[model samples]
Target: MSGTIHSVSERFDFTGDELAPAYRAAVDAIEAGDLVVMPTDTVYGIAADAFKADAVQRLMDAKGRGRDMPPPVLISVVESLDALATDVPDAGRKLCEEFWPGPLTVICHAQSSLMWDLGETQGTVALRVPDHENTRELLSRTGPLAVSAANTSGKPAALDVYEAEEQLGESVAVYLDGDRVSGGQPSTIVDITGETPRVLRVGALSLDQLRAVAPDLTSDDDPAPDPTDAPEPKPTEDAEPTPTDAAEPKPADAAEPKPADAAEPKPADAEPKPAEDAEPTHEVKPTEEPAEASNKGENNKPDPDVRPAD
Candidate 1:
């Protein structure tokens, strides 16, 4: 929450060109378990030590986020995938091999001892290998970083160093301004929880582009409701009910007439169904209709006059 701004990449300033020192400072803060807001190819992100629970909690609190949505953990490279996630499926590996160091967030099941408390993980976590050089270098020095876009809840994401500084204010220990972002959008998030993969959030990558890299990719297909509102319930139409009169039961006018002849009950024999309603039995023929047609004129019998000489 208290620190300095370091120009760690081209996007921040020309000084970030040799960014190891500033990145080192951010790494030091992370080692001491403090938050660092740094630039990714997409937008500025607030990061904390993945193993530091308290630091992670501060990140969640700072963003005014809930447990349902956990912060994603960014790794330096794809090799770190197995360290934080489980069951690296073919689809997951395929995508990682293809578009990883770009704008793609792969959501997979988390390993049990990941050590950070970002939110209610429900045994799952999101991970990404960022494309930015400063981030890669910082993550190389520091381990996996639990991070999200550096902005207050519900506000637009930070597009530059100043925007991040203005939005994050005192929440993050340091803001590493690299410069203008590589791309102007967030990462394309894909959830690989089920047997089939689902895109949780669509960002820079298109649905077609994602599937081309990983053929098995499918989308969850739910576009979220408008951010401005909790939808109001539709009103129901009111109608009036018609009243009915109560009636009293009347006695029989006279004694009921008796049957002229006594009827004998028949014995049950498959229970006589109404004659018209009985199910009919069908027989199966050896040669089917299609097979008979296929044989056609090939198996025709010889004519009597033609067979006489034989």
Candidate 2:
């Protein structure tokens, strides 16, 4: 089926009497459950009514992709996110506030009540608010649309409407040519199903920019360092000592020595010395000898006197 192509202004003038025919045709085709190729801020995309399961299936068949890879839903306004997603985390809201109307797609838990099937989305939907005025105007009229890159599976994304038309051909009902889009990259996709938001794909929006709004934003390219897998920090000279290190006892050889003068005293009554004999000697015998001698001499003199008298 050879598709019809229409050239339109890059910017939509809502007030002008002359409306863009291409936009009108695209909206009509989407309402009829037909796919339309349009230019987004990032790249060319083929869009369909997200609520139309058959139309979404047809879109997958056209792209030669299976139901496993679901297409992202594109909305005109930020408010449409609430209608499609449920349990919107604070990080998801902040990301929308910072990066909506730009290149950023958020994956969130799908609203259980919504009657729509986006292939094998597994109760989750990826959504984005593109930064193109014409596309936004179309989305405002069409509500939410299931959109994917305008190329077959495994092929490079179509940067221009011509490339999209060349690849998709008659599969798409209407082609709105908004000139060559500076398709630098696609929207960055962040999955908010977990407690921490993780970047499934790195695209136009850098991880740094996303982190500014959601500090916990993570990337598949740069995964968070696991606490268990992290290397134990090596001890440094200036590093603070750990409790185990501080509680260690000192070596036994570091004790102080005792003084030499502090010895014990000896016993008092062990042995006694021999004392001299207590006798006093004198020359008193000379007096007794002199008295004997005097008696003898008197006797001798008396004998001599008797002899003289005779």
Candidate 3:
């Protein structure tokens, strides 16, 4: 069955009155278990009533996906998460608080009481609250819708309704044209079913950004280790001694005297002598001429001879 395309205003009032005709048609189609292609914040999505197993199957068939792969559920408000999931962890609530109505899909334990089968979801379902105004209005009237990227299983996801129509052909019952959707990567997928929340796929929301809300949130690219569970380092026999052990003083009895302690005694005779006398002695002899010495003696010889004779 070829689908009919309806033109929708980009800035229409979402009070369920301005786009009454389009909303009426979309709600009717979804209620009748028919597939509808709609725009989301990240990309265009083909949606169906989440509670209707036949509608979900038809959605999977349109995407050429099998029961092994399940479609994510799109909710109008954050409160819907409580109804859809059981044991919604505090971390999951934190992620919804920070990134919901934007581009993050959280997977958690599905409500056991709900009568719905999304293929091989394994008792868990992925949910998101898109930021698009039109989609939110549609969700308000249609309740939770089982949604997936509007394209074939292997093909690129449609950024606009026309591309979705081209890829899906008549598989979708209604295509609400909301003009060209700002092209961007798909929403990030995070599974909070385990003790440690893990990111299955990275897309619009980054791991670091998600960590801001849930510090324990982990991604396939970077896994964080739990500090409390880290193992304490074991001491090895060859391990170096600690500073306290090495700083300890040795016993005084075992200490040896340093080189400054040994003194040699000096003998009394080894004292230094007077500097003047210490020099070598020399003989003092007058260098007088023989004639001068004889003259001097002859001049005094007469007096000396008279005194000797007396």
As for lDDT, the candidate ahead, 1 or 2, is 2
TM-score of 1: 0.66
Single out the weakest 10-residue window by summed lDDT for candidate 1: 239-248
Stretches of model 3 off by over 4 angstroms after superposition: 1-17, 223-310
Estimate the TM-score of every prediction.
0.66, 0.68, 0.67
- Per-residue C-alpha lDDT of model 1 across residues 1-310, encoded as one tens digit per residue: 4233333322224144677667767877788777787889898898888888777877777777776778999999998898888987888878877887989998898888766677788888899998887788788888898998988789988878888777767666666777768687899999876667789889988899988877777777755777557553332222111111111111233111222242644233324334354332232223344344434322343332333221
Best by TM-score: 2
Query: What's the lDDT for all of these models?
Result: 0.72, 0.76, 0.77
lDDT of 3 by residue, 266-299 (tens): 2333443344443222221222333354444344
Output the worst ten-in-a-row residue range by lDDT, candidate 2: 301-310
Model 2 steric clash total: 0
Clashing pairs in 1: 11-178, 11-179, 12-177, 12-178, 12-179
Q: In order, how many clashes per candidate?
A: 5, 0, 0
Per-residue lDDT, model 2, residue 157, is 91
- Candidate 2 regions off by >4 Å? 1-18, 223-310
